[model samples]
Target: MNHAQIRAFHAVASEGSFTKAADVLNVTQPTLSGQVAALEEIYGVKLFERRGRGIEITEIGRRLHAVTLRQFAVELEAEQVLLSARGLMSGQLRVAADAPYHVVPLLATFSRLYPGINFSMSFGNSQQVLQGLFERKSDVVVMPNIHEDRRLHAAPLKREPLIVFVDRNHPWAARRSISITELPHHRIILREKGSVTRKIFETALESAGVKLTDILEIGSREAVREAVASGLGIGVVFESEFGNDTRLHGLTVRDVQLEGLEYVACLKDQKNSPVIRAFFDQIQSSTATNLS
Candidate 1:
């Protein structure tokens, strides 16, 4: 098949809609449709089954799409290899992260080291970050919680302790530390269900036999910080991430200790990629010095 026809077919098969595929390819809908039609006519085979506004991939289409996926991946690797051999300083790196606090600093450091490298970052919860890595949408991910996935290579960044913060005007503001059992008696504001911070905090509470009763769920860390500063409820976060917010008071939990581990990760097969390796090396060196 001709390149244009194959591209149109692949786009359509991936997107499931001609209109969306055309958008992805930056081509007019008619032109995309014509290319795909030409391919099918030349081959004397039906690649897709049309339904009202959507299309379903036929058996042959599915087979072709599988081939295209592998083909595109290999093509991308070939491009990277050529770029490396040419000693090119410029390329794009897409990174996904569960939190900006863990990612932005490392990215800033990388940018300074390789000024020509462009970075595009997307933020989500831990689950979404992991999903992006698995789907090959991102070159690397910065995450707090990692599972035992043999397909991934993870490097430790830092371990941060989870602490509590409250409004400056709240009763607990004067206290330097509080026991874990005292948590259930107060209104606690925490990150939403998917948060690794929330997961670690909850696990610690469970281990201490202190159940969380009065709780308010906030979706973002900034929102949680602001709500706590407004005297809504106490907030839980990594001590290093709490920063120096003047309106809030950060308190240590004396009886319970919870630490969240940060990691820089890439697919095991891609660990040796030039760009990924450079970034990973910096993280390893930086964390090692901090630990020492």
Candidate 2:
């Protein structure tokens, strides 16, 4: 009946447990349970089936939860509108990035300009980044090599050449560059599937007819870097991203024409959101000023 009771029920239904739902709502477990109980009693409908420690939402609960999702989303949008009208003095901006390399610097610049705005970041592969945007889990996404998607608007920020890297102890460490055909001779460590960098590099290799014999697939960029630095294998990454790690040496693939174009993107509907707009504006200003 009331927003408090609705919020309690929604949280409980979404989280599937009164304890966890109470934690999410920042209220005591008993208080949260009381609120939900009152709502169900008033409506004369059982929203959830209580097991010993677990809870299951009934069909009616699921329907009500779906409606509450839209209702709360609109409520949040209203709050953001008010915050935007107040010159963006305070608001939360959630961003998802494929890697910190492209997003951290940009967020740092935005924070410097609007210190009051709270920013949070999540990292995943490019596919996950896009999925976050679609699921409304993130306000924006930073990635590279993203193709055109009508549901989103992507702005290219920078292009970085794909390059090879190896540990100092590796025989190829002393070399400034290597040929694409020579890849099979060295152990190749690649990022897992859905990684844009891995896709680009692999596409280039396939086009060049270079089939790597020894391949290791790692899930994270940090892992790939550590593996290569430990002389486990040769790693490929964007030149701009592979910072000056003294333990590893970067080498250009002489005949490969692969590059990653970093981009900042958001759902097309939210492209004009105050937080998203501000971030894009900062990118433009920074690009014009060559701040990086």
Candidate 3:
């Protein structure tokens, strides 16, 4: 099938509604339907089944969609390669990041350095970022906790200490330090599962046999900070990630001494393109400066 037909099939399958897909493709519903129909006829398999106003993608359609997404990525990369060969500096960099604290700074630096390169960035929980890396959806990932995988390469970026954050009016606000055993009585705010900070806190708590009494699960670090500031719960996060706000107070960043509890940079099989290598070097140099 033609690329347009393949794209139409992918869009329809992804949107799960002909009308929605047409809107996304900026084409009429009839045209989108015709393209999808043509693709199905060529493949000799029904791609989707009607389900109310929406549609359910068939197994064959699911497979095709996955391949087409990768094919599209490869085609884009090929174009970039051609441009580079013509002495033009251009490429797209896709990165999956778990936390805004780490991502925002790095992206700011990269943007200043490589204004010509386009970037596609996604924010997700640590698990989602890792999955994106495995699926080849992202060229690189920044995550807190990393799992061992043979197909991946990882580098430690920094080691940050975890701290207890409390509302300014809370009794703990005046305290210099609090024991880990005292944590269970306070309402604790935590990031969602797959967060490096959450995993580290959970593992430490488990090891100390201290189960939290009240827990609030939040998706964003900013949300967690706000919740803690509003006295909903005390939050556990990296000290470096905490913004300077008057409403929030923090205790000493100690008690749970974690090793390698920092943002880790990961890539698949070290497939270091020139852009990727340059970005990596820039980050490394920045990290060195920060440490010094």
Candidate 4:
């Protein structure tokens, strides 16, 4: 019924624990519990069910939480609008990056321009990054390759080529360029499932009728690079990601002959946010300059 109760309910629903929600809201546990209880009484429905040590949101709670999330977003946007009218742009920016290398430069530039704005970044595979955007956990996402999603509006930030890398000791290291079919027999080290790189690689391989052998899945880009450097397998990564690596020499960046991929995306509804718009503009201009 009140902003305080709504906020407490949302926090508890998100964190799944009254104690953790209290910590996040900087309120005592008892205060948070009382507010939630009051809201439950007003609604005449149990919002959450007690689990072992935490709480699970009830079906009604999920619906209410979704509505509350939108309401909170609208409220925050209203505040941001007021702040912008007063020539102030000070707020938290939550971003999820599928590929950290692609986001670093853009974030650095944004930080330099808006020194007062706080940034919270999370790194994950492309699928997870997109999920974060859908869940409203991240305001925007930077992805190496974006798939078709009705809920997202993707902007073409940059189109960069994918390159193949191998250790210096590998036999293929001496080749200038290897055919896609040649890769099926080699040990291929790829990023974990849900990564754009993995998806792109798989699609290309499938198209070429090249089935890779002995695939080793790694979680992070750095881990993939290390695995390739140790002569475990060859890896396919963005060309920009291979800068200044002395140990692992570029065998030959085989031009997969695929179209360059997009690197940025935003939730369709969140595109109206002023902060997100500004950041998108910055990224567009920066990408244009870099590509030219």
Candidate 5:
């Protein structure tokens, strides 16, 4: 196996750009591209399709990336093991989350406590973020823990209720709560499918026999908020994530309870890793200090 070629391919695959991959690997773009091209040439397979000013991984490339994810993860573990002897001082961890509100606080706490440690975060819907965890793209993830899975070491972080909101001048602005029955009257803006908040909201609507007539589906929280703020429609989100947006007014879905359990989780196999364990412990310690 050509380790250098595989590393080059993995960098490009993960970073999604030749420029980014080269910068991360500290190599010239030509050198990195040559390494990947050589790998394909020697293997007699097409790995990436050149798009205009970009590239797309082929089916075989994705399959190979899956294998490389595990291969490099073990390599990272080995490196972490060697570095642990230096008092767990220097390390990098990748973190993903379905939403930023819950995980961002934990990250802030972790950063304050472990100044030497470096971390990166990416956000997506619940499904996308969890996929990143399982695919080894992230060492840990923060997301809703609604499903049971033995493959993860999940620590419950918080339970926050979902709320609906609208532009400040909307008819419901003065109200503190809304019923599922009342939602269908105005256009309802929601996160795209796979969002925990949207899932809970939709499930409740289904149970309540509330079928929304006018719907505007958006792909992210900030976008949905902006859509609502622009008077396009009503938007639903976690109470904690509502923030202090003066352009909007938040109203609880008081008729039926809608909440999500935030959890900081790592693969069960990786819970014992030094940085992952430290993160888990830090959250527990932070929770304890808060309760005390």
Candidate 6:
């Protein structure tokens, strides 16, 4: 097996861009391309379909990428073992997260503890970040409400209730809380369908028998915040994430129990690796601090 070529292919497949893969591997783009091309030529099979200004991994390429993900994870474990033996920690640590609010502090702690480690984060909805974690594109993920799976290990970070928000000029701005039934009276701004917060909110609305007809589906929390601030609609967000904004007011939900329960999760097999363990330790300690 051509180890260098496989590494080149894995980099491109994971990043979905040759330029990024080259930068990641510290190789010239042409050199990276040459490695992939040589691999394809040797196998007499085209692994990628080149479209103008982009490329898609073919079915074969995806299968090979799956194998490489496992292969690289093992390589990561081996490397971690060596680094631990030398009493030094260095190398890239990739994190995927649904939001920046909770993960940022943990990252700050880890950065302080392991200044030699390189860090990268990719953000998405919970499902997307979880998928990235399973793909090995990221070593760990900050997720909300991930299901139990034997293949994974999760460290509880937080569980906070969702709150309603309105612009300062809205009629309910002075109110400290509102019942779920009140949601039907106002236009609401919601996250996309895939959002775990939206799912939990919807479930709460259903349980309360509140049917909100006037709803706007926005793609991100910031967009929902902007919409609410512009007086487009009232918005909902986890209490922990609803930072103090002068233009908006957060009201506790009176009856419904919609909350975001987040975790720092990684593959069960990789949990013992030094960098991942360091991360889980910091987050767990942070959680303990919050509880205390």
lDDT of 5 by residue, 141-227 (tens): 988854778667888777778888999999888888878889888899988888888898888898888899999999888899899
In candidate 3, position 227 carries an lDDT of 90
Candidate 2 per-residue lDDT, tens place, 1-292, comes to: 5999999997787666887778777899999999999999999999999988788899999899889877776775786688777888887799999889878988898999889899999999999888777666889898887788866788878877899999999888778998999989878999999999889998998999989999999999999999998889999888877998999999898897988778888876566667778888888855543324
Q: For residue 276, what is the lDDT in candidate 5? A: 93
Winner by lDDT: 6
Tens digits of per-residue lDDT for model 1, 102-126: 7999999899988888889999888
lDDT scores for all predictions? 0.85, 0.85, 0.76, 0.79, 0.85, 0.86
> Which prediction has more favorable lDDT, 2 or 6?
6
Q: Is candidate 3 or candidate 4 better by TM-score?
A: 4
Better of 3 and 5 by TM-score: 5
Write model 4 residue lDDT over 61-100, tens digit each, in one string: 9999889768877876887688788554587779898767
Query: Candidate 5: deviation at residue 236, Å?
Result: 0.2
Give candidate 5 misplaced runs (Cα > 4 Å). 1-85, 286-292
103: Cα error in model 4, Å: 1.1
Q: Once superposed on the true structure, which residue ranges of model 6 sit more than 4 Å away at CA?
A: 1-80, 289-292
* Clashing residue pairs found in predicted model 2: none
Can you give the TM-score per candidate against the true fold?
A: 0.73, 0.71, 0.66, 0.72, 0.70, 0.73
**Model 1 TM:** 0.73
Question: Which residue segments of model 3 deviate by more than 4 Å?
Answer: 1-88, 258-260, 264-266, 287-292
- lDDT string for model 3 (1-292, tens) is 4989998987776556788778767899999999989988887899999777768898888898889767765765775576657543677788888767777778788888878788888988788888776555778888765767655666657667778889999998888788888988888999988777888888888887889878999988889988988889899877777778999887863566643344446553334465665567767765665433
